[model samples]
Target: MIGFTLLIALVGAERIAELTVARRNRSWALSRGGVEYGRGHYPGIAAAHAGLLGGALLEAWLLDRPFIPALGWPMLGLAVLAQGLRWWCIATLGRRWNTRVIIVPDLPLVARGPYRRLRHPNYVAVVAEGIALPLVHTCWITALLFTIVNLGLLRTRIRIENTALRQAADTTPASP
Candidate 1:
């Protein structure tokens, strides 16, 4: 349980790091005329993520969720892999990477890194981590609820981002 708690704390720290990066990137993007989309859902996204970490701790401690070695080890690996993928997406996007959909016109969609194969690799990391993190300590309830909430959030999020991308592309003038 002590180890699991530390793991969650580490994940929380990682989330803080991501938000700090996102804040800096958001400012950079906006300064260069980046238009943000889907601001409304950002709060829900933050809440759901916070809930994931908190719920896992509460459920594991209060409900006495035991760590099954077979499940825990594999889930831990997946969580770590998800973290790697998340960072890859961040590095690939660089200053353009943000928690909110902020598109700079005339900039073509990223084609390198994980973006080459996955349209939304960051979300892939989010989904994978959400599941694997909770399941690490057998917090099945948190895993289930968080997954359900994220699916709804992602559906809206994806639609807004695609529309924003299309609009930005249309607004950008074609090269001579």
Candidate 2:
């Protein structure tokens, strides 16, 4: 139980750090005339993420889930890998990365780092973490529920992002 609590605390701290970085990046993007897409869904996304954290803790504590070493260890490893991938995405995008879908017009799409292989590598990390974090303590219900909801949310998010990217590409002036 104590270990689970510590895990939650660490995850919470990481979330705070991510939000700080997002805010900084947001400011940078906005200063450079970045236009945001999918503002209508931003609150839903935020609420769902908050719910994920809270639900994991509740399911683990209230249901008294056991941290099966076999499952927990592997899930922990996946969670760590997800975090690493997420940070790699952040580093790759640098000032362009944010929690929201803010795009600076006419900028070429980033194709470095993880983006070279996967267009949505950050979302991949998010999906992996969504599953791994809850399963670390055998909270299968939370893991499954979050994954389902997140997929639905990601559908809309990806659509908006793709549209924005297309618009940006269309508007970019061709160099001779």
Root-mean-square deviation of each candidate, in angstroms? 0.7, 0.8
Q: After superposition, how far is residue 152 of candidate 2 from its true place, in Å?
A: 0.3
Stretches of candidate 2 exceeding 4 Å from the true structure:
none
How much lDDT does each candidate structure score? Answer: 0.96, 0.92
Q: TM-scores of all models?
A: 0.98, 0.98
lDDT of 1 by residue, 85-144 (tens): 999999999999998999986788899999999999999999999999999999999999
State the weakest 10-residue window (summed lDDT) of model 1: 167-176
Residues 1-176, model 2: lDDT tens digits? 78877887888899899999999999988898999999998888898888888999999999999999999999999999999999999999999998999999768999999999999999999999999999999999999999999999999999999999998889889867
